[model samples]
Target: MRQEKKSEKQEEKNKECLADLHTTDPRDDKERIKQTKGGLLEDSSNWILKHDDFRRWRNNDEARLL
Candidate 1:
């Protein structure tokens, strides 16, 4: 009976962990561009890019590069 109780507690903990793992907050590209100087293309093979935000960021520190 004690072992069954412990197993049930472990199952509850696992369910909570799985819920946390699957949860994510939606974020958009514009917000990301403003927050981060650089952006990435969706295609895996696509090249890294620098946008207007990157230019602004680079302007602040010339040493920063894409």
Candidate 2:
């Protein structure tokens, strides 16, 4: 029940995000970037590369993606 509500809320939010995609203004993007200045997310790919599963995959010769 709780999960359903969360899923519905997320679906609504996704719709809202797409609703603006077709009509985004450059000024809005500039302002959004300015608002997030100095707080933008940094790369986290290193964390994934260091995980044990990733290490195993990197070392394995027969672990094809398919």
Model 2 agreement with the true structure over 1-66: per-residue lDDT tens digits:
999999999999999989867777888887899698843466646789889999999888888665
The clash count for each model shown is 0, 0
- Worst-scoring 10-residue span by lDDT in model 2: 37-46
Give candidate 1 regions above 4 Å deviation.
25-53, 56-66
What lDDT does candidate 1 reach at residue 59?
A: 75
Cand. 2 TM to true fold:
0.34
Among residues 3 or more apart in sequence or in different chains, the pairs in candidate 1 whose N, CA or C atoms overlap within 3 Å are none
lDDT of 1 by residue, 1-66 (tens): 999999999999999999988845456646667579666556754323456665676577665654
Task: Please name the candidate that would achieve the greatest TM-score relative to the true structure.
Answer: 1
Among the numbered candidates, top lDDT falls to 2
**CA lDDT of each prediction against the hidden true structure:** 0.71, 0.83
